[model samples]
Target: MTAVKIIKVLGTSEESWEDAAQAAVEEASQTVDDIHGVEVEDWTANVEGGAITSYKATVEIAFPVHESSGDA
Candidate 1:
């Protein structure tokens, strides 16, 4: 049997939405492990004065659940 878990993360990039997604995954690697995959949940772009400014994306980060043996 395998355990699984889901988490939500927001990634922002000045270049493109793809970069933002990659950034989120890269940053998440510092705390998360056993990454399964990322799914794009919601996405939106920032615009001002009728001009595109930036991209914002919301993604779901899925991974296997792990139990820690650390004591509190």
Candidate 2:
């Protein structure tokens, strides 16, 4: 049987929200494999000196769960 797992991740960037979202995916890819898709759940930002300092993205990452083969 094949299964998919979804997890929420937060990414931050000093640029645009798009970049923040991409950052999330990239970071997740470092640990997770076979990433099929991502959904941006929310968007947020931080303000410093009355200006937008950074962007934050809340994303849901989806990947297939690999079953371990009976090799041991």
Q: What does the lDDT read for residue 27 in candidate 2? A: 97
TM-score of each: 0.84, 0.93
Model 2 / residue 29 / CA error / Å = 0.2
Q: What range of 10 consecutive residues in model 1 has the weakest lDDT sum? A: 51-60
User: In terms of lDDT, which candidate is strongest?
Assistant: 2
lDDT against true structure, model 1: 0.84
TM-score of 1: 0.84
lDDT of 2 by residue, 4-24 (tens): 999999999998999999999
lDDT per prediction?
0.84, 0.97
Q: How would you encode candidate 1's per-residue C-alpha lDDT over 1-36 as one tens digit per residue?
A: 778888888888878888888878888888998899
**What lDDT score goes with residue 43 in model 2?**
99
In candidate 2, what residue range of length 10 has the lowest lDDT sum? 63-72
Best by TM-score: 2
